[model samples]
Target: MLRAAMTGAIAAAIAVALAGCGAAPSNSGEGEGPVRVTTTIGQITDIVTNIGGERVEVAGIMPSGVDPHLYKATQGDIAKFEDADIVFYNGLHLEGKMTEVFEEMAEHKPTIAVGESIDPASLIEVANADGTQVYDPHIWFDVKLWMQAAETVQRELAKLDPDNAGTYEANAKAYLAELEALDAYARERIATIPEGQRVLVTAHDAFGYFGKAYDIEVRGLQGISTASEAGSKDVTDLRDFLVERKIKAVFVETSVSNRSITAVIEGAKKLGHDLKEGGTLYSDAMGEEGTPEGTYVGMVRHNVDTIVNALQ
Candidate 1:
């Protein structure tokens, strides 16, 4: 599908156009100017924009509410990659289908894997039935961890366009400060929920980092990646668990279908527990471009407030 989406003319243009990368914009007067940054997901796009500020022209592949795990790049997306001076994406197979596209682009330009900066020991590893473990790619849920990603962005931007190094530095410092406050807010607000009622049930386990960082027990009907389906047994198991614990709500995600979650809710009702839909949480994706939930900090803030208001 990827090749089909960007075949013949687009593929032929990549090699020729890539030779022109890292050049200043047409109007920038002969020096390294604004970096043409193309990112795979909106979370990474938000980070690049915040850290790079006015120094980057970012084109994000997967927009708000698009699931990166299931996203397949289009012809236009391929063109964005070709035009970019640098490409940034969440690693650990988050953008699974785009792996080949990233590989092809990295050979020509400064393609960065954002998750590389994070410590492996700190990652949440989900074990498959075959006994292999894949590290969770939803690192943006932990504000502190996400801050590291922002730092990575600024560091790379400084390297790519040295003339604007100071600007990137200043922007990163300010953004990191806001992230610190956001992290504290998450910890404190989640702490406000009654210990027993603090359980967060969502359709997918994208919030492992959030739950771990905030000291809440998180249960998901599905696994880490939304690519996996929530089976009937999964629903029954979660339903019984919710009924046993009397969990008041289970949240749905903006990027994922809520059918499994709805099933869980209905099943809980049949078992005599009136479980409510807490609210929609931003999981693998965010809200629209101009909305509060569009940016990383805004998305995190919204999720924290929603969880706290629902459970506390």
Candidate 2:
């Protein structure tokens, strides 16, 4: 019912915005300047900005530390979408609240779902509450998977701006090679944390792909979507798992509240186990702009360094 109401509101808002949009701008007169590209998350924004180089002007609606799962589109965001020459987002419902907006805008623009291009078989399938399987949208957590996303962005950009096709391709190739190096670095660094200390407990299930790629055990207090609550049972179960394994640290997420993880910590303490916040992980969003974690590669590196240092 809540989802229905939110959807209704977004639909009405989009309708009004479109109604007031007046005449559509001439597609041919888009001008000989930077291709205005609007992306959903900072990770996408960073890659697009890098790959687009001087050919595209990239902007993201969701800022650092903003939870994408529950982010609702506003009038300003709708205007951004309307003005953009191209739009890119991490699909598979990562931006659950903005699905309608994306669908509506894709009608006339090159709105691309970067994550959807990856082969479905390569995606992690998890059962939903209603017993339906869905692909995990946190593909960016795995550097290799994110390479696929980078390629998708390049393809779309090249298609939209054919004159700059060579540049986009070259940039994508360079970025992909960097991603390969990042993947190798993650594996090497994570392997140094003794086998028994490979467990990564966090606020939510955002690190599944990360764990799968690096051979670590990941457990989270809440589900993949932060919209779901972590009940007492969930916290108790995680606390018991921490106590039984004697895990010393659990990480908090940038986009999620620390309360749930804190509860698990207190629960573990009550059961004669001591735990601390391992570190803050960038789950749904990256770090602040102008910082190292602001970029995707840097974000992944920071997470790996934090986890390895804490768990080791």
Candidate 3:
């Protein structure tokens, strides 16, 4: 029902947005100062901004603190796609309702799913609400995995604008170095927390990659997608896990409701376990534009610092 409603809205808006828009721009990268790139999700937008550098104009479809799992593309978003030289998004159903929009745009321009470009073996498999298996879409939590996404963006940008391939390469190399440093920082900081206290619980299972990369245990009240509501059983189970494990903190996501987390916390309290509300996490979304947490590196830094400080 949620997906259907979002899709209907998107289809209507897109039709109106493209009413008189002529053929899609050829995007040959000739006779242009910079290629216009449209992307969904702040993570991908940041990647394009860094890798494309001065050679691309980047715009994001989803704003900071917006849940991509439930984001319905607007007419303005359709206009952005129609005017772009390329579009990039995190696939594996990250932009659940926007999948068709991306597909339609792909026929007109280079539409790359940077997250899906990563190796299958590297992805975490989980059962969907219906019990079918799918790879988790929140790949940015793992800095190393996101580095791969950066590389994918660099490669595609080079393909799209060979004239600026050198520029993209140089920019990507620099950005990658920063990400490497960020990854090391996450590893070092996460190591400071005792193994027993390294557990991270969030509103949703958006940190599985982060847990695997940093050797911490991760739990979420809801499933991979926020569309999958947390049932009373889920809250009870998580509550018990926290109490039994003596977990100290539960984190809320900027894009997800804190109601479930609150329920889990109250349940744990009733069982005589005091749980702290760890600072907000930028799961499934980034921070406000221009803020430190708005960028991918800053967002990861914020999350790692928050988790370590809380659980330490």
TM-score on alpha carbons, each prediction = 0.91, 0.94, 0.95
For all candidates, what are the clash counts? Answer: 0, 0, 0
lDDT at residue 37 of model 1 (Cα atoms):
88
- For 3-109, candidate 2 gives per-residue lDDT tens digits of 21246776677756655543455232244688888899999998898898988887799999999888888777877777787889999888887777777777666
Candidate 1, after superposition: displacement of residue 177 in Å?
Answer: 0.4
Error of 1 at 30 (Å): 4.9
Clashes of 2: 0
Alpha-carbon lDDT, every model? 0.83, 0.85, 0.86
Regions of candidate 3 where Cα sits further than 4 Å from its true position: 1-6, 12-23, 26-28
| Candidate 2: 10-residue stretch with minimal lDDT | 22-31
Better of 1 and 3 by TM-score: 3
| Candidate 2, position 161, lDDT | 80
* Clash pairs for candidate 2: none
- Write out the backbone clash pairs for model 1: none
